[model samples]
Target: MEFQELINSPGLWLASSVMVIAVVIQAFVFLRAALAEARKVGMSRERYIGGLRSAVITAIGPSFSPVIVLLSLIAVIGAPTAWMRLNDIGAARTELAMVSLSSALVHGEVGTASFGVEAFTYALWGMALNNMGWILVSLFCVHRMSKIVERLYAKYNPAWIRLLMSGTIIGLFAYLLSGQITSPMLHGQYGKLCAGFVSAVTMLIITRLLAKYQRMQELALGLAMLAGMLTAQATFG
Candidate 1:
């Protein structure tokens, strides 16, 4: 297939667009709600106010690089009902190569050779798939943690506060899992399993710490900002 044909593929564009849109919308809605509600909850007024601006820039920075190619791959992957025999292998190789090339470019790793593009491609796609798998699993950790917080808010907290807090944490977790830290974990088979385990523990710890806050919105935003900052440092540092 011609390169242009590859570029013009709608499935690729759709998948990429969805991922980008989801992450963007998720970040904005979460931060905004967190900011507005922070004052109600008694979060350090300064940090709560400043965090939204800081997060918008740094949190979404990483997605700009990979979302394009990632979307294209999603288009080509198509529906599982369209899966084939050797054609599947060929398609998979193409995706793997794209992901590998993208990853190498993003990290300045040595480029994959054209001669073994097929195998390298397979490895790369496998890695991407693995990373996504871990993310989904890690998100479960976030969800369960949010539910606990939800119960706490419903029982002892205000409705607006619960909405703001739950919304922000859920949103941040979704974005963070999609960000760069997930890249390495997504590639390795065992990496996601370890990540999921760690995330579960971490979420529990965060939940406990967050429990101290009577004002859920401010705390949620503050924590989201903190997570976003740490992730940026980890990814680009």
Candidate 2:
């Protein structure tokens, strides 16, 4: 059998759906728990539901960030494997790299050379092993990390600690944005920089100028991403 046929078989799709189904189930369970807690804390249903709507909208924009690389993954690894790996924790690029590395182990090249069933099987094992490592570490370390955070909060001023934690998240996003915006500049291109700039401006406008519109505020991130992507496409494409 050809590699593509095996990778994208109906059985593979059914198998890959396991992760997607698990994610859906977890989402529903968490949503129910959150609603229960909201009732216990005397939060009105309207307010909590609004927050949920906003969170979902906010998530939609960042989810699109993976689409370009996701297409490449689908092309090289076939849709079912790509679907499963993407639904897992590993980044799309990292998963693609693992496939390449694993295929190399069996002397097969992806999308070019004779990467048959054997190489594909090895690639599956490689991604599974790589993801297992992350799962194991999270299993062992999450509680410890939570405890450390709790102790730090107890030891330090709560306000300052909150700010520090906020700063850490901000720093992480700043690094990610800088990489996207500046990398292309090194190659004399400004598409990513333009997109990032447009997105930031859109966010500021939504938050500051349109503060009275609660719905818009909730959708600020998604709107900003759309505006940025459109702007970049018009300017660069």
Candidate 3:
């Protein structure tokens, strides 16, 4: 079967549905637990209901952050797989990275014509395995997290702990971004270089210049991505 055909096949969709279903069920379970806890805390039904409504409203803007990238994922992978992965991990980029790494096992470049069923299968396994690592780590390590945090705070200054957390987030994105920009630089892909630079600048402008606008801040990442993609297309095409 053709790569696209196999990816969108009934069997693939059925397989993907299992994960999506699990995520939905998990969400309901968590919601139930939270509501129960809210009652235990003596939160009135009216207040909790109001809070839920406010939260739902607040979530709308941030929820759109993934949509542009989600469409890209849907285009490269099939809708079912993309939906499953997004629901499972809630991070489009991470899932795409896993797919790219996995597809490379079959000498396939993601979204390229060279990709086939073998590459697709490899990607499936890669994403599953990647998620398994998180599950296993949580199963073993999560219970110890509180003690670990207590020990860290006991040993290190609280200010330094905060700095460490902030630095860790910054370092994660830096690593992901370096992988992207490094390949383009080495391959003389100036269009990609332009895209990255433009995106970075756009992000800074939105975050710094338009800092007063809360909605714009929420949309910053998506706006930057659109700006970058458009710039690259215009410059390269």
Candidate 4:
């Protein structure tokens, strides 16, 4: 569709608005959390901002996490087209149907699909805002963890363990998305179970690996556990 035509489309506008609203809500929650953490830590504004940078990296986990399912659905939708000379066989997967459905339910795909440019634009920016919000929260978590380590430096001989745990948690989350073990979005309790299992397993495996690498990383692992619990809730709860 032409840009003008796309602009005129009601669907597009609706989609964009939904996207904007989702991200804005995420940002508000994140900022509130950040403010609370800042007060708890008694951190200067500069340090808070600096911590935000690190948090951004951590926040990345959730921002793109949902995309794993979204892209899978897109691939699924595009698969038939390719068979009709639209999709490449290299990309086809059974996971698409499940992930798409899950995402549809969570994101209100019906409402979004009805929208066009507006939804798309909002989704784009909402993703950005959401990630930023996530980063802020992650920063607070990381900073708090860092302080814990500093205070108990003598007992925490394996500081590297924390970073490893965090990295592993992030990596495992990536793996579940990559493996597409089961379609989480399909209709039924089984679909939710499958999604929850995959998320839980990923969290456990990553935490275990990090723990083995460093004893001091136990604190971070605890955080990972919290993340895992939250992830499970978000995906299937």
Backbone clashes in each candidate structure, one number apiece?
10, 0, 0, 15
- lDDT tens readout by residue for model 3, 111-209: 788777788889889999999988898889988997897788889999998898799999999998888788878987788778889989999999999
Model 1 lDDT tens row, 1-237: 543354345655564455456666887898788777887788987775555554454455443544454444444432221222112223444554544555554443323233133433353455456556657876778889879777877777587776777899999987876563477756754444344445455445556766675445334434544554555455544
Which model scores highest in lDDT? 2
**Lowest lDDT 10-residue stretch of candidate 3:** 53-62
Most accurate candidate by TM-score: 2
Residue 9 local lDDT, model 2: 93
Candidate 4: worst 10 consecutive residues by lDDT? 81-90
Tens digit of per-residue lDDT, candidate 4, span 1-237:
753355445665564455456656888899999788897988887666655654665565544444454454433322222122111111223233323344444453423454344433443343344446656887789889888767656465566666766788989987865555345444353544554455466657666765564332333433553555566667667
- Cα displacement (angstroms), candidate 1, residue 19, comes to 0.8
* Candidate 4 Cα lDDT to native: 0.50
Weakest ten-residue segment in model 1 by summed lDDT:
80-89
- Segments of candidate 3 deviating more than 4 angstroms: 147-237
Backbone clashes in candidate 2 total 0
Give the TM-scores of the predictions, in the order they appear: 0.35, 0.92, 0.62, 0.28
Q: How far out, in Å, is residue 114 in model 4?
A: 18
- Give lDDT per model, in order: 0.51, 0.90, 0.84, 0.50
lDDT of 3 at 24: 86
Q: What are the root-mean-square deviations of the candidates from the true structure over C-alphas? A: 13.5, 1.7, 6.5, 15.4
